[model samples]
Target chain A: MMNQTKFEELCASFALGALDDNEKQELLRELEESRPEQLETLKSYMDTAEHLPAGVEQTDPPEHIRAAIFKEIGAAPATEQQQDEATPPRQIAPPAWIRAAAVFLAAVCLVLLYFTLNLNSERIELAETVEQQRFEILDLRDRVQVAERYLEIIGSRNTYLVSMDGLEPSPSGFGRVFYDPESRAAILQVANLPASPPDKDYQLWVIREGTPVSAGLFSLDVDDQKRYFVLEDFFEEDFEGVDAVAITLEPEGGVPQPTGDMFLLGSPS
Target chain B: MFILFALLKKLTGDAQEEAELLIAVAGKDQQALGRLYDLYKRLLFSLCVSILKDRHEAEELLQEIFVQVWQKAAAYNPEKGTAYTWLVSLTRNRAIDRIRSKSWKNQQITDSDPDNKILELIPTEGSNPLHVTVAKQRSTMIQQFLNKIPDEQRSVLTAAYFEGFSQSEIADQTGLPLGTVKSRMRQGLLKLKEMLSGKEDQI
Candidate 1:
């Protein structure tokens, strides 16, 4: 036991935060060893010395302080403006919806004409079958090319690879991917996806073995950005034999086995 | 010493959070810098006022502090001291430098309020007011802790805290032996800490 009086004096000094570093340490050490009462006493003082009563609000910060903070945030580097100037002007000749409707009408007319011609050419069935098979092959080839380009992007250091395949609702719309592997940790992007319902959202999953693990949930913001939904993290090698990457429209937090329709799937190639 | 170590650990832990914020500021996230400013503004402002004694000069010094904080956030090393200690030291140094600068000779201190010198900050008056309130509360606690010390000892502490003076400088100003001033200052702080601890338990 050290002198209680001296210890109390030290505690007072400590609460005021006046002691030098070494002196503070020594006093606290002595208080800890010899006097449990002083230790408890000092704890109270420090605690009270750190608390504040309620209703002590700052009425207002000077408006100029607020302005300076905003100005600093908005002062983008001049290089950003230069970069914006380098882009070519966009041509806005016709509305996109009107152009889409015109294309749809033209397609309808072409399909009707094909059906009439096919009805007349009943004797040439073999040639028609061969042509149909050739067209199917061409479509498959295009899909592979698209998938390859997506893989190239995924391999970049900036993106994490996420795989999702069909599970429940709309099982056939399989094999969608999401990636966001950059320092910015940006928003998710989806690729090779089909249209989803207005009330539903497309959730990305990192499947491990037989389980559907949610990487993140995302929806398309614009038509131009396409099916690419930026996701959180990639499915590392731990997800071996992941049955298929699946997307389920769950009530936000996503589900274990995918409660909603499995909109898409991508098996390891 | 053990208790002091624990106390330092608690305070410094908070500093680490600020250091992380500083890192965010270096990335030019103005909001993070604003949060940092909000965290330390009161103590920093008080410290400036304590030395400069002019609100306007202190306000200008506050702007200079942030500018330096922005420019040098990358250089701060957590290993040197807690973020709070580092920041307070920085603010003190800047205020001392401002006082000593050639500009001080040209401008005379007037009776007019310095609130007019407040800098224009960001426009969005943020959502989290609680953080600033908590910091202010903590400063009040620290102030109360200072009040418990004897007047003679309190004067020495006030000089050290406000003017950023060394022990020898304090001794020279007060006409006391350097050793006597140092010991009294040391003893005064120890006693204040004890009183604060006892007062805290009563609550």
Candidate 2:
């Protein structure tokens, strides 16, 4: 029994989602008897209510929601028209040979891709193997040269053998140096030495009158057979100026002066 | 500007289009339904999210709303209101029902909103890209209108509209008498109607 203005007011709240449930039911009952003008007013109020949330950020539903909605209603999407037009019923099925050709092409492509991939990996592995063998060959040639040099230094008439004994740092370590004063070439042969830490290398230092000069660095890894290290450009000074040859664990590359614990020291026998 | 004009023209004709679209939907014209969805998805979705405050729940409710629209498209009476009004009513009722019945407020959008296989919603109008722009425009107008309303009245309307509070609940929340809440709500809504009327005439 609501008056026209009261009913309209309640309809406005109803549109705004503020109407009580009981009052909503009452509104509906009034709705059945409303004239067109009244309903039009109600509609405008509802539309106004709809717009009231300009403050609430408007968000588009996820696109998948569109697909989901179409799926739920069993309706084709708007894009279906073009898709339908593009695909005629009669042309839906391509020629059987075309299908076979497509399948064959796909299979051929897959096989080619598989073989190409396999061949590419094999080529890389082969290159790596060749590279490894090239390095090994270079290393073998260098070893042969060192052995020849060691022999030449050992057999030289002016060659002198210096017996080296282990220091406190490596009591069990011992080594020998053969120097040919004429060629100023030297070779070191050592054994029973602890492995070098990754950050440290064994450096050979030649000390003369308390002034030590760096000989060179050598790594001790693998078997004892390849223990000989040829000292390149052995010394800038004459052999007579050399007082002693000592090996120490220095930084990766040898330093001009010995700063680490001496592992071995050698002088004239 | 041209796009805005096109949308306005489209919205102007929306009364008939919406009715026709619903009729087609009743006849199970899915394309028609899709057209309708394209038109109002943003507006209705914004309303749903505004009420539900949970995007997931809003999305689920949007699906249910569309499904309900499909099932009841035939029952739609154009004489009662525009198609927009009908869609809004459905969205509002369902969202409010969820917030109230499921204790959506108390339950924490744990969103135990059971995965009911609900049907979809949307419209059968043709492509209209400006629907989003149109929603934004209408929202801007509403904001201006609300700002123009007195603070007390605007507050009551906002609480009632967004919070879905009843007059008595609003009275309690605002610490105002029930009679005062009712008066504020009526006056605010009357102002809204009047403002909208002036806008439509301008258009």
Residue lDDT tens for model 2, B129-166: 22212343566667678788899998888777765678
Write down the lDDT of every candidate, Cα atoms only. 0.54, 0.71
lDDT of 2 by residue, A1-269 (tens): 67876776676676565656566666766766666566656655555565565546678888777778777877665453543454354236788899999999999999999999999999999999999999999999999999899899999998878878889987888999998888888888998788887788999888888788887888776433227778757886777867888989998876767889998998865
Per-residue lDDT tens digits for candidate 1, residues A1-269, read 55665555455444434344455556645753644455555544433322311112223234365445445546433222332342212123456888899899999989998997887687488778889999999987876765665565566665434444444544444444534344223233344455544655667665666667776666544432345333334543443465556556665544555677556666544
Best by TM-score: 2
Which docking category, incorrect, acceptable, medium or high, applies to candidate 1?
A: incorrect
Residue B160 in candidate 2, Cα distance off native in Å:
2.6
| Candidate 1 wrong stretches, greater than 4 Å | A1-61, A69-269, B1-16, B102-134, B199-203
lDDT of 1: 0.54
Give the Cα-based TM-score of candidate 2 against the true structure: 0.46
- Model 2 chain A: lowest-lDDT 10 consecutive positions: A82-91
Q: How well is candidate 2 docked (DockQ)?
A: 0.18
